[model samples]
Target chain A: MRDIFDQIRKRMQPPQWASWQTLIFLSIFSAATAALTSQAPPQIAERIISSLGWVFLILGTWWFVYEPDVKKKLKIYELFIGPWIVGALICIYLFGTWEGRAIPAPTAFVSWPPISAIVWSIPKFIQSDPKTKSPIYTTPTPANRQNIILVLLANLLISCWFQLYFEVQDWLAEYPSFRAQGFEQSAFVRELQPPEKRLELSRGVDYLDAAEKALKSQLEGKPWAEVERWLSNLDQEFPTVRDEAFAQLSRVAENQLWNLNARVISDAYDLEMRAIWQGPSARTAEYSLTKTCRISQARQVSTPEQLKFNSPTPPALSAQQIRSLGTVQCGAASSPDSLPQP
Target chain B: MFTDVLPLRAILFQLLFIVLAIAIESIVLQKYLGIGQKTSIQYAATANLASTVVGWLVFFTAESSLPPSWRVQLIGYIFYDRINSPALLIGLAFSIFIGTFLLKVQTINWLDQILGIRKPSTVEVQDPIKFRGRTAHRQTFSELPNRALGVLWANAASFSAITFLIAVRTILPPTNY
Candidate 1:
């Protein structure tokens, strides 16, 4: 080992031709691999190729540049490059799926660390006064800047291409639906209704309408305290009315208080109110009637519950009663609880 | 004297190793592990970027890649991805960047080790009154590249194990099947 080291020390230096040869070999290997695979290669193979490529490139360059004598050169090659070559063959045997059986194409550009390292080391090796404190050669120079730009562009292009390809496939798969109703409309509908059945369209529309009415009343200069009162009454009359009231308050506050930047704060308040009102029992008619009455009073009108009780049954109430009964079983026959008669 | 000129060969070897490592990682190791193409690609890209950038920075800085400030900043940024809604993509991106940077740093150090590149320890002339004088006194340490190599090997090993798991998953039919 000592003799080998001494010999390597004697012959250590790289030739220019070797760099070009290495690059060529890499290109060929990449091309051959891609040709054989005919598609994006597997992950493990790609990683091994990339890692081993870097290792060999650096080690080879080190040996070619630094090894002084033939004995040293041969020894270094045998120790490092030999194992790599054998490993490559074994890897091909173990992992190769295709008949041609070549390495996979490299997705990235072929630049390696040793070249950059050497470029960086030049200044350190050449400067007469090591203590002069000059900037290291690794500092980006015009050439390096050009290289960097090239690399950056290549990476961007590759990434963009990959992204676009996947997006195009997704779009293509959904194109028929999009074409029938337009992309915007389809997207809007889809966003409103994921397949999980979490959102109900009819309920959503009703909630939106209630929200709008509440906002309109607020814009007409109804005080927040009045709105809160009306919302609380509404909650007592209509248990599910909290979402609408909160939505309305948020919309009105957002539009009216644009100058105050209070929209976020108001929205947060509304969210908190909704959380409290929508608590477990909000599904009860008692909770609903109380909430609706509170909101109606905040709107500075006679409570909607009074009007509702005086009039024939509101269609909204009938629907709400039906929904509540769907889940609650009342007797041996699982009968729904009847709405209280005024 | 020969050591002065062997950079070309070293560069070639490094390039070869990187490519091979990526291939092995993606095809053999990742496959066995049950990692799909997307995840494997992500890992490859991140590792590549991390290794390259860190290698360049360290070789130039005369330092190792494990400085506290850098670790805090770069690794911290990676951890920040966890909070994102679609975390996988961002996580992959962050991991790739860090992995590649580390790989590059390791590669250079590895070369230094194999080639026995040593820097002579000598005191530099300094201005006694200047605050910058202390900067000259700091000795730049280059860690052995084997550490970085070890990390890469570990990654490969883990990936390979994953591939094996995936292979087992596929080969052995499910009880339902």
Candidate 2:
């Protein structure tokens, strides 16, 4: 064992091409640099070189693993020793992650080694000319079938890792309220930071605000006569208003995850809008944020024509005053306890 | 970013557990089976690594194939560190514990067979295995044929050590870290 260590030390070289260790270090360094540079703007050369370093790591490790052992490389010995080292490190992300479909651009940097290991199996199964980069016509070797199975299994794991990353991100984005909760009950995850330090995700409040504004714009500043007409025919008008509400929101809402309902109660003099969150949530019951846009008009009995007239100087009028054509005033969201009675 | 969200601590814990297992298993094998230090270490490391690799594979399969409702709990566990129910977590943990123990035991047997390693006769290596942690070291390497009983003892020791470690980590004030 001591002699083996000494032999490896003697074989170690400074340049990446001459030694696998140097190549591994270089690959790791380049991957770190790329990850750091990605946070800001990266230079074209830096990006290219960082990407190329991974390629070197892949090829270099493959060469070292297979080159010395073609004598008995296909046997169980090479299968365990060579790839296991690289695979152990690779397992960090693959095993720790919950799920993912495939390697995205950023993940592909450190992912090159296992991928190279997978690619190495190809030649073993079917002969290929390395220098010419041409496939030599040959059937997949039955003796090396395990190599094919191993590669397929590796890819399957990689897919789950990437998929899980995306899944977690999506889940958190939807249920921000769950972040503050304790993870003691969880075996897979835990809260590292306290509740105060974590980000405050506006839980459907922003959506409600958008919906209110949408309703106000649709109802406010209209001629009193037209306002009265539209209010009476809310069935015909509510669809467009609701559509506009959702249009102001994110495409991710897609009218399916979120639904905005707007209605004017003539008896109550309220243009109430409810933005119920139908998206993924920790709660069994969904959260519904309500914004009641008070429908008001000036105390003065202004004629329809007079109401349309522009006033150069606006008066400081509260709910007591009613001078404009009509006003749909919106304030903060109301509790989701119950819908207001019409 | 996804990189920022990576479970680096989990990976570190796993590596730490492997090292601890290898050490404990080597000690058990070296003392009980009358094997050389290097030989015992080799057997312990090989079985641990193989089991770990397979454990990850099983995790991926179960994760991807999870139903929609269970997937929600999985996401919650992965991201927010919360699970709505403890039943799933408990069941999953138990299964993994038993699965890994079996895998480790089988891997040792497989290595022994494939490598044509010679084991001492029942007369040379004879001792009873008391499941208790205190007497386990002294209790025995059983009269049964292969390295099965020895591997079981080793795996059990390693699992207890890892479980204690996990309990310690979980008990620590999360904010302090």
Candidate 3:
């Protein structure tokens, strides 16, 4: 274990070729892969790109820097990484513009320009070292510079294409509304009735409108007196026409009353109601009502023994009859006793 | 002293590096750029001449059968193939050339540093190897090819493998319902 540890320790120390150039190469590769995987739309693309970058970076570094015999070979590999990186960018641009649908202009602006500038400057930086008065400027020759410029122009075209694609997609997804006048004209042709017919149909609209307004106002948290008064006024206004209107109004009122009953039932079941009715008298009232129905049904049963036992029975009753009697009788008998003594 | 012609080991190492570099570059680009794996492989391969012609042939053959989107995707792959893969080959060649020159310089520097050899200002030691000799003299940096043909072949092989894989994936019948 100690020997293995020692070997590992020895390996950690970087060799001669482990300079700023190698570090920058690794960093750039890392950044590129991160950007690709992190920003790429499809999940599969992201994973593949990230894994490939990692595997290549490690292999390239190991081949060039670690293995003594392959040092020269590795250096050659490093040189290729730059151009290949440029190629990758071009591919990204082409795919995005042609196949990937649209290139997001903002993303291209954010990611590509800086990356291009950095990559373009690398050869120049490497060529000009302060220590060496004239370091060899190997890459960024006039020909390479021309290629870079071409790539940049291609990227710009692709970016514009992407923006246009997104705009089209947005247009396709938009909902047609009144503001979309052309869309409204085409889609809602049936909704646009003839103006004279529309006006004729709405001729008696003012009376109906007035009735609706009065009903709405009378219904707004007022006593039944105000509603009755409004109904009477409506009747006086058009005695012959008022019957049908009143019938319709009555149906609406019935629906509202049913809804109110439902709300009251719900409120009774609420915690607030339980707290309000927490007294012994309320509990007794509830119990008696439940019990009275059972007693009344027991009396109504036509068993010979029960009939013989209650020879003076008041009346025979069905289950529903017993329930109704229980409700009426229980309320009448219990209300006074159940009320607060004060 | 004349050495044996450039060692096979050196060539093999160079080829290995070329493959490794391209694979890494392709993977990185695919992972980050949201490009398809198939596209990345194609790009990695056709960046150089030996592979580009083959890639173009494959592309044109596939183009008629594929949808417009796929064709566009293929174009992207081809573009990357032309740029990154070939550039990598060129970079590798340059690095090899530079590394060799640096090694020679370092050797001379080491001798002077360790042996305390005083320079006789009168005479300069000329490089033993010269152009057009039995010994392979290193070419002046200017004379090296802009791109490496050997690296291109390596890329072509990788591209072929990738294209084959894509074809196999597409052609094979589904096993599951």
Candidate 4:
């Protein structure tokens, strides 16, 4: 490690200060890149110049944070942590920052921009000496190696933890019904969301919308006779409709966690589809959301004359008896203590 | 340098999951398959690694063969944590469960075949002329009672435990798992 750093240091000697030519080159690079990527000049110039200035400030602070240009034992953070901070700041400024998604989440505690600077300043306050001059040529000792290894391991562990957090986020995003469940009995996860604020972002309504759209597209604009015939074999036909509706669901995932089933509430009057969530929950009980759909004669009358043609081909089905969704209603989330669990 | 070449995060996660699965499956195999603790652990590790290796191989093969749109989705899901479609995720999850179970069964049988049978002696003779008459015997395979079913139960238990851990992690701090 010592030999590697030594070689790197010898090969990559940074100038003591930014020269005029280097500054001009950086400015032109930033300008060209910004102009190529952005349509708005002012905003582009502002963001690009601001980021460049901040990067400069970060590197500047890193160099001058030490007490004097003298022989002093520099800690690891003082020597190397600036790049990490600058990287974080660049990532945030370039890509974006996000609002916390989980309960009791720490947004930037582990990855804030100024953390390196703060950490680097600590040794400066404690170990600063006026007599010290700029000769940091300490040989790598066993204790030094041990210290470096410990810091590396600690950083690795923190990165692994962040990766785990990302993994959980993936699971939750892919399987969002898990978010609806209670976590009181869980051993690994604990929810800190207040009781009153729970279930505020329930995806029940969105799921119902999908189910409703599927119901109308599948059965709404058909003959009443065909509708009755389909309802007659609800056992077989209901499953097809359920699959279609569930397929249309963009809520979380398909055929997993959330269960969608439909039955004729009133064969000719309305159809009721129930979406039961079979996912991890914070609550002890499960909830089912329902949506009711009906055919409306009024909507078909408003259809353009293009519908009268039905198909460019000779169609066998009734084209004139077009039906549209009417009085569609989605019920609130209700725990099905009495209803059979899907 | 090493970190750039290898996915350190993924390795960390895989080792953790493998360890957890191995611990649980070992216990399950010991009680149900009637194996000694050490043998159970060895079998579980072998089976888990076999399934994991096969899974990664399948992933790479599919990634290379799939279309650009699908490749994007797979890459995004794996690297960016972007679940483009729930159907893909659910199907992948279901396939992994079934695939792991079947793979573990075959691997456990293979491991059992090796470990359960006593290997023929190495047949080392310091004096080749003195031991000229000696012959080495062939090795044999051993059969375990209810090996497939035992692996099934163990697989199911470990999968459930892992799913539960993932579920619980939704509300967890970034400390344990």
What tens-digit string does per-residue lDDT give for candidate 1 at A61-167?
44444435533554553542333333333334334433443432222112222223333334333434368766434444544433343344333333333332333
TM-score of each: 0.18, 0.52, 0.21, 0.41
List residue ranges in candidate 4 displaced over 4 A. A1-55, A68-136, A190-205, A216-227, A251-255, A264-272, A277-330, A337-342, B1-177
- What is the full ranking by DockQ, best candidate first? 2, 4, 1, 3
DockQ for every model comes to 0.01, 0.06, 0.01, 0.03
Per-residue CA lDDT of model 4 for A1-342, tens digit only, reads 999999987655545445333443454556566555655645866576657755554444444433253214434645554435544544454444455332222334334333433443333324333478544444344333333333443343454445445444554465544444433333333334424433433465566676666666666556656766666776787776667766666754423656777776763556677777654333434567666665433345434444556556454344355554333434544334324548
lDDT of 1 by residue, B9-54 (tens): 2233344445655665555424443445644443454455445444
TM-score-based ranking: 2, 4, 3, 1
What are the iRMS values of all candidates? 23.3, 6.8, 32.4, 13.8
By lDDT, the best candidate is: 2
TM-score of 1: 0.18
Worst 10 residues of 4 chain B by lDDT: B136-145
Per-residue lDDT over A137-162 for candidate 2, one digit per residue giving the tens place of the 0 to 100 score: 66554334433544554444444344
Error of 1 at A271 (Å): 17
lDDT of 3 by residue, A252-328 (tens): 11111110000112211110001011111111232111001001111232234334545565434422332111111
In angstroms, how far off is A255's CA in candidate 4? 5.1
Q: Pick out the ten consecutive residues of candidate 2 chain B with the lowest summed lDDT.
A: B1-10
RMSD after CA superposition, every candidate: 26.4, 13.9, 30.1, 16.1
